[model samples]
Target: MEHADEVYDVIVVGAGIEGSSTAYNLAKFGKRTLLLEQFPLPHSRGSSHGQSRITRKAYGSRDFYTQMMAEAFAMTDELQKECGEQLFINCGCLVIGPRTADFLSKTKSCLKRYGIPHDQFDIYEQRKRFPALSFRDDFEFVLDKSGGLLRSDKILQAFQRQFVRYGGVLCDGEPMIDLYPGTIVSVKTTKGLHRARSVVLTLGPWAAKFLPRLGLNVPLQPLKITVCYWKEKHGGNFNIENFPTFTMNGAAGKHHIYGLPACEYPGLVKICLHHGPNIDPDNRDGVENDWVLDAMKLIIATHFPSLEKEPSIVETCIYTNTPDEDFVLDVHPTWKNIVIGAGFSGHGFKLAPVVGKVLGELATGQKPSYDLSHFKINRFFKTKL
Candidate 1:
């Protein structure tokens, strides 16, 4: 079933946050862009389906992200204005850990370095500030005032809507079975073969298998993270108005945990480990993740006395991680017109605006504003393109 091969200025495969954002930016730039997605719109098959994601200006390890978040925050506000809808909640982001945790110390440094508004609370002050949960041990808390939660579904929808309003074509439920890279790339999807002067790949977990077919391989491991929710037992300040989005770094070789206050489900708090077992995205359900649920239960019981120990609801999300946690945002080593955005490592939803902006610039032969040295393919440990 081949339709008319209307050659577009750019074709972006994958309607996830990154790809949708790339198409949105391209359309905003007045480029004739086409966005293709394998799954149906609003499907829970990828990372972007998770209802809420944290958006913050400070990074514990990467300074580049800290610097880029300045624009990401502004872009988010701009997107909200364009959509005429509230896409985020400014509840702030609280990072809780031991006093000596590098995440705490480095994140504090990043806040001061970036001049992001933040407040530090000692163990006693933290207990007074947040009385809903108790720590296993004395833990200091750092609250990034520039951080908050993004309404994931609404944000994705806004990108698609704005992209279409800007005259970009968005096609979903049509999987790209093959790609032919050249001066004018030909993307062979299930429905038709689309032609474009340039292409951007942001296919999430599917990229691992899809890229190998193009004679290029990189270190993209997909992990299935078990997202769990617990019922609120004690009537306390567990609502978003009261509780902020929070992350707890592992103290001593334990699982790093993060959660959102009562947003995804009613009377149930979202909490899970920041790690998961690697698996093929096509066959994610085959992996046994009961151990992850066990870990969450222990975490909840140890800290969150207001919530039930046993998870009332369990869900899943996929994270495509590189050996290094940094993202892969660069052009194909051989094909200059084909740009790649992959290996977000689970923390990229907040940074997609900058990533998409840079990817759009690369696809359109425009110079990227940010320093992409940290995200280049050559820096990859495997280094095979």
Candidate 2:
């Protein structure tokens, strides 16, 4: 493909889930959008790789997320229809935590407020139903019917294809080296210089590197989290029928452990810490730390007794987390034409579809379909004082 010096209506940086979805939405509106990526297409170097991601409307505190999931599900459904492929598989999800914990209580509140069907079970009942699970008396589990697994890579490819079908241009293997934010945002890329009416930066972990230069000081901590898959002792015990995706909360001061049923790798269940060790994305390929690996092993022993002590497959993924763990979605204070989406905090994949539409609306100067107050960039300013 030849590089052309042309001005697009919108320039989207980063071809991850958020960027691809936003580009697709813009192209659907017949806008000349350019999707940019630093790495070549379909590379596992980014956070958006992997076979499946848990997609569930199991927000404990953010009822707004539940509201957004309504639109997200519809949008994903439309994508599946247009692509003639099944990207979201409905396998349900099991959210387990102490009833007294904020996670479980707030989730129940959100479920009731949104009328999302879920079954609340005590620990005894949960242990009986799913014999592979073991929990104490204080812990309660909710079976969320609206949750399922999302084929992330396939979804990205599907959206990219749909965006092109709608006449969108994608420049993969190109990095945005410089950006001139003005009425016409000029972007200098490896391929060539391209101008666009508006720019949306959804660069995931690399967002902070450019955001501060744009007069937006977002304190983002990029952490390298390990994606460990533990082999199940009895393969059928972790099957989709017997096992469901689980999010576990420990007693006070203990971190959370979440896992998905066996699917990606046969006999291996995907599990990872809700938090991670702070590290740079460039050096994320280093050898795994013994302390972290031991901690994960302990978690599996305490929670999932049916899984092996050691992880059969270990991979690395990065997360840009915010202090409050909510997302940062807003326009730059100086450049209204420039929109930013960052600090997904490890739970952004399930909300990418709705977030893309919202980010696209912000870039295009259209009224956002949902309230943007919760995810505004100005919130951090209030905390500084």
Best by lDDT, which number?
1
The positional error of residue 50 in candidate 2, measured at the CA in angstroms, is 1.0
Q: Kindly list the per-residue Cα lDDT of model 1 for residues 289-374, writing each as its tens digit.
A: 88787777778877887888788888889999998889999998899998999999999899988888999999999989899999
- Which lDDT values do the candidates have, in the order given? 0.88, 0.85
The regions of model 1 sitting more than 4 angstroms off are 1-5, 251-253, 381-385
The positional error of residue 148 in candidate 1, measured at the CA in angstroms, is: 1.0
Could you tally the backbone clashes for each prediction? 0, 0
Best model number under TM-score? 1
TM-scores, in order shown?
0.96, 0.95
